[model samples]
Target: MYRVLPGFHQIQQPNGSYFTVPDRYINLFPFKVDKPFVVQAFDRVMERYVVIKKVVLPDSFLDRQPWKRAQRELFCMLYIQDENVVNMYSAFTPAATREEMTEFYIVREHMQGTMQNLSPPTFGEHRTVKSIFFDICRGVQYLHAMNISHRDLKPENILMTRDGDVKLCDFGHSNMEDPNANTPYIVQRYYRAPEIICETMDNNRTSVDIWSLGCILAELLTGRVLLPGRDHVDQFILMVRFLGNADQLFYSVMNERARNFLNTYREFLENCQPPTDIHSHFPDEVFQGGLSGQPEECRMARDLLFRMLVINPDDRIDILMVLSHPYLAEIWDRNMNPDDIPQPQPPEALRNFFRFQNIFAPETLRDEIFNDLREFGERFNIFTGSKN
Candidate 1:
């Protein structure tokens, strides 16, 4: 069920006494994709556009009290309110005064559009693409310091503002990178990392995001998906053709199911003449004239891409190294030094691998979300100008 109460802010009374202030949000439209409904709501009080993503709790799941499921995702989204990340304005379950509520709503600071909207011919300039990449790295760096993985990173989910500010949104597949738990199908098909597709446990969580970023950066620069695979098998073929095999060790470590896939594609691998050079695939024109075109900056950016688009997860560049890459100096912020940002204590690991299997009851989740905002306040001094 979806509901939008206009001017949720408190209001004044006709009498000398005052009523409630105006509500912070007002619903503009109801959007549906499949069964769940996502609403475009306005923050009447704040004067900002906000998106309310609905998380449905079916009767069967509710029987198990799956609050932890929703909690895990909300926790990840609300965990840190960083500028590079889409801010969670609030989270709550809808309950009428007379009846109990059934589902959850995650309210986010609505963005103008997504990075997908900026694909080439429209905004394919190199500097424009560079800005997009810088923000992505900044967001992932924060998640990595907390020992978390985005699990899913793609253009559609990366929101961008009118001023070129980017916000990484959608932590629906985020996790703490537990070695023990087998990762479900994580990233979207095109952006899926080789390690993730192979189901190799040897790779760490942060590397997965880096790999996805590599794919994203390539698309932003080239105005096309680097590897647009029709399926897992095709994806493997595409990667092998361009990046070459990651390592034989990646094959040995693969789980039985993944190994079987390689066996099926063995003939194709044998016949395929892997290209010796990848430079031709990313032409000089694509990097130079289209992007900033500075010879030194282009050289450094190409080098960074080489490190990120590695076939092996172990070979993938470290997330911190990306921030320091010389190519990014134009957009880099000296105050936001990667060395100065210490790791944060991640939220307590969700006891149940709920995966949004179950989550907080309305009041329970709301209280926790409010606490997140409060924690953000204490940590950043946004409210009292006091930092921890």
Candidate 2:
């Protein structure tokens, strides 16, 4: 049984152990709207800490966007299980009935801090950065192989454990890889890909994720955001300035709106020439404390970044290629068997749910979510809703 205390929530397991979660959270930002409230919990059975993410469901029936995003996040987490990905313990609603359910809860393994929040000294060593980046690549590679794209991959979404293990989190913006999927407004502006801004994504939805990874890598090395665009136009202009003008092939693929924008700012873009030396952006002092400052390692890192941050999506390095890159060679296991790799199999129920276009109705979505919860409860031998 699960019950709420005056200032805390308690969840009882069938094994006679319990989990206690306080009402307050460590990462609460009152000014930030729409952010989920995450609180740490103590699991008596495991004798370890966990995180409980509280998601408030919209009251209005007409608003189903948030509900859909939450459902998508849950399904994505269930679909992919990897060492570099955050692990979900369980999920439930405390409300006895669907009508009374105003909030949903997701319990997951505890992480020390996010890449964005951790101090620079934590990543002062170059090998540490490489290892973290390598883990991220592995996670992305697994997702891509499963035909999923993590639309939002930023420092804030990269979680780090106390043991220095890196895991990817926040799948609210994730979706199955579809070339024609028109959601250019997905990733954060700073890490967004050029093709996404141009709205020219086609047959390569994963490329956007790669672009985001490049931005994250740059941030890890320099201790700041690489492309800090104030707005959509600024982001595109900055990208052009760094990578030079878009090629004929790239221009040919651009939509009319993007083309118009380019023509409007053609003069300004021409003045912002590409840098002669990309290495200047990453200084030796940043990696000098560790062996990562070696000339050979620095060259490999720069070369990898160059390939990843290409102006054209078609020219960008794919996730698999990134895993095989020489920079990540130390972590790549040569003796690993192909059969040992875990393949993602999206649930049949989820596939069917997505097939219905008109299922966005609030009532319909609520029912589907409840059904999913019921199924999860059965598999995990946990209580999700009242039997009565």
Candidate 3:
């Protein structure tokens, strides 16, 4: 059984445990706007907040669950074992009320908004992208120093306070440095490494995280998802198009242990050749490269991005080397203050734009369809009623 306590209007679980912010808060504010909402606890008087979550595991997944309560226990232990990662004041199991039933939750300190919200200088935001990448590198370096792999890293998971400091979050799907391994690879499909799909067959570690970060770096520069795809298969295809396809030698590069693992998936990868001339499929300007910034610096960033988004995750750079990369050093040497960065206005005015369907084009017929769907859902109770 778990314990729960009252803190002002919010609830606290046992030390070191994480519980989802009550649904009331889960779909609130910026978090609500973002899907797969994050949990947070807010204090009105102190102007402080805490992140809390409870991962509800389905009973049917008892045999196939990738991690355990003990793994979560160990995740809490990492905060104690390493300091480079974010600080966790406490982490313990706690009781959560769900209707008439009660269960456990996970809780941790709440970090602030992420770089996704930060607007760079209109004069040239690419420099701001370079500066932000340094902060990301430092945070990632700290995680690697502690031998932890933040496998699910993305802009949303990387929190940036108003003062411009950075903290990496979302360790639920991370890989801890452990000698005895139990599960296969795990990551959000878009950011997932190819080794998980192709060669190692899901044996993931530090290198996989570096690859994900690289993709994130590219996205930050362009304000778009670098390898956006509809689903895992689409993402994999996009990856092959941007980067070359996995070679036959990829499996041979692994050790005997991994090679033995590859035997099971050889036939699958053999037929997994990506479409030829993937780069040619990209928009002409995307390949022609007309963005701002020193061409050399831009090229450097692109080269690093390419290496990280490779078809083979094993070929990607690790945290240590990324930290040592000249691009990072050059960016940091520029001595940028996030506050001083200029923000360019959106191309079109949004004063009259409706909030519910904040899609790019309001005139498009899809907006009308979406507005109708929203109205129907609200009137007919197509979706669940609000928890509050």
Best by TM-score: 2
lDDT per residue, candidate 3, 1-388, as tens digits? Answer: 3333332123333343334333223322224334332356553323346554444533332332322332333333233322223544333222223221233333445566676665332214345665667667766665555455666777666777665666666665554454344344466666666665443533446776777787777666565667777865566556665664577656654456756765665565466664454333332234222344355656656656765666665567666566556666566464334333322222121112212122333223222323433443355331222211
* Candidate 2 runs further than 4 Å off: 1-36, 61-64, 119-125, 271-292, 333-362, 381-388
- The local distance difference test score of model 2 is 0.69
Summed over model 3, clashes come to 23
lDDT of 3: 0.49
What C-alpha lDDT values do all the predictions have? 0.64, 0.69, 0.49
Model 3, poorest ten-residue lDDT window? Answer: 347-356
lDDT of 2 by residue, 1-388 (tens): 4346454555443334344443332332221123426656555545566776766667878777677777777666555567888888776665556676666666678788877766355454567777889888877876676566788898878888666788988887766666556667877899998888887755237888989999988777667688899998899988987878777688777788888878888787767766678777555555434545476777777888888998888898888677667777666644233344445554565455444523577876676666766576567633332111
What is the Cα-based lDDT of residue 53 in candidate 1? 73
Which residue segments of model 1 deviate by more than 4 Å? 1-24, 30-36, 61-69, 96-101, 119-125, 202-204, 270-275, 287-289, 292-296, 333-388
Give the Å shift of residue 57 in candidate 3. Answer: 6.1
TM-score of 3: 0.61
Candidate 1 structure quality by residue, lDDT tens digits, 1-388: 3343343333222232222212554554543333135556666545667776766544443343334445566766655657788877666443332134454557777777778774445443456767878888888877777666887899878888777889898776766666665664867889998877778774446788888998888776666788999987788789887766555777887888888869887766666654565455565567523464455555666777878888777777777778776667667544335464444443444323333333445455534544544454456433122111
